[model samples]
Target: MTYEIALNKAWDKIAALASSKKYTVKYFTDIYEVRISDRMMLSISSDTPASEDIAILVLHYLTGFLKYGYNPKEEWISFKDIKGGQSYYPAYQENTIKPILEKFKEKTDDLISYLTESLEGRIVKGGDVTVELPTFSDVYIRMVLWHGDDEFAPEVTILFDRELTEIIPSEDIAVLLFNLAKRISDEL
Candidate 1:
């Protein structure tokens, strides 16, 4: 189905599930907020071009929550750990990791600074440059970058929380990583 159609369907599902699940819709001037039962579940802004994608992702999260409940397991897991992940290894490396490595080959520090300062990421004590970043209210992704010199080429690896597989589709996980790489690589 087209993204627009899928999004509309998502909205319908969201509304129905929200009512049955007692999720209260909190009105915001520029954003949408949903309170599931008592706890606030999602807050997404409508002022950006990516708002549609955000809404769709939020719907995915809500549906996943309804299906699996909250797993709460925070173990860091690589792409290989995700379902059917191994089959997409080449695409993941080419589409996500390679670009990051290329962009930050000589400017690893700058990327690190941007992620830490601008994105509110925390530097982890590992890799040449390892950071833990929260891309959404409920999603935390880890990135490990290894800068190369004369001998070796630069490399990057992205890992997701173990619960992420249970929260969103694997393809969406790749999309999130791609968005993150673009944000990090874009001239600022």
Candidate 2:
């Protein structure tokens, strides 16, 4: 029976490790992934609630997968292809995609200034454009800002096409990104 348990032991182990993301909540199933997002949604805006584990599990396993070890680049294979995968986000040539592509390029440069690293994510000069990033975490942020006023809801989109950019935007994700930048900067 998959149920919730206080993630003391798991978190304890995580604390011993040098990682910032601690698995404090326990899942009684084989969680393939864990997401930190709004735990609940109310019909109205006044339904304010805290974020909680929106975990994706595999089967019966005590601990969920550790994303730290999961290379963000790997999940981006099909998203990088721009033409494959079971389902897809249409990149019609006629839409505002052209302008969005241009803006995305500008944003990539901005990220380069801070990240000091090269990634698969890039903005094509012309043609059908879609946001593809090293991690599934980055796709939404890329789209939201690029979409701007035309943006839909300006919130996270779980595009099942692939984990093109899952820029978690969580404390742990922030810490990881900063550390990654730091590590890259140190190399320079």
Candidate 3:
């Protein structure tokens, strides 16, 4: 399967796993979105907007949490920074982040497992352009994960270290950064 096909498949898998409202921009070709919500907690997107890609999942949370929502063009501080620097996510938000973090963990783990099963670690190339997996799938997959170099950015580098990017992308590195809008709505 091609990356585009794999990407699309990834979308279907996640949507199946997450039971929530799904939306589409229409303007973007074939690009669809899924808005996950749990009545007892939060909606992945405050507006319930989602993209077919997981990057949309990450984007939904990062900017949506702000009282006024985050602007797309602006730079943002990821969850790791917030977690690392006591100054990022204030103490008052601790309880709020707990469950969402758990959900994020669950979603992240689900994707990783799905990819390992589907990809079989036998191919490293994207989409239809394929390459055979070396004798060591573990080591080969890890190398594929480390495509970019920006070590000082611990938030970005560490994931490739764990072979997450092999499954997910750099855009949605940590699930914690995602906004649990459904959770926020449920609280209200």
Which candidate ranks first by lDDT, i.e. highest?
Answer: 1
Q: Each candidate's TM vs. the true structure? A: 0.77, 0.23, 0.20
Cα lDDT for residue 65, model 1? 71
lDDT minimum window of 10 residues, candidate 2: 55-64
Task: Report the lDDT tens digits of candidate 3 across residue range 121-173.
Answer: 34344422222221111222111122223662111111122332233333443
In order, what is each prediction's RMSD in angstroms?
5.0, 14.4, 16.7
Q: Which residue window of length 10 is worst by lDDT in model 3?
A: 152-161
Q: Model 2 over residues 23-121: C-alpha lDDT tens digits?
A: 232211111222223222121223332122322111111122244332334332322233332232243211223333343454544543332234444
Candidate achieving higher TM-score, 1 or 2: 1
2 against 3, candidate with superior lDDT: 3
Q: What is the lDDT of candidate 1?
A: 0.69
lDDT of each: 0.69, 0.29, 0.32
Model 3's TM-score against the true structure: 0.20
**1-188 per-residue lDDT for model 1 (tens digits):** 34787677766666666546443222212234554443333545543233566557667766667667655576888887888889998888888787788777767678888878877789886678898887655566788888767998777888878888876889877777877777777743
Candidate 1: misplaced stretches above 4 Å?
Answer: 19-50, 66-69, 149-151
Q: How many residue pairs clash in each candidate?
A: 0, 13, 16
TM-score of 2: 0.23
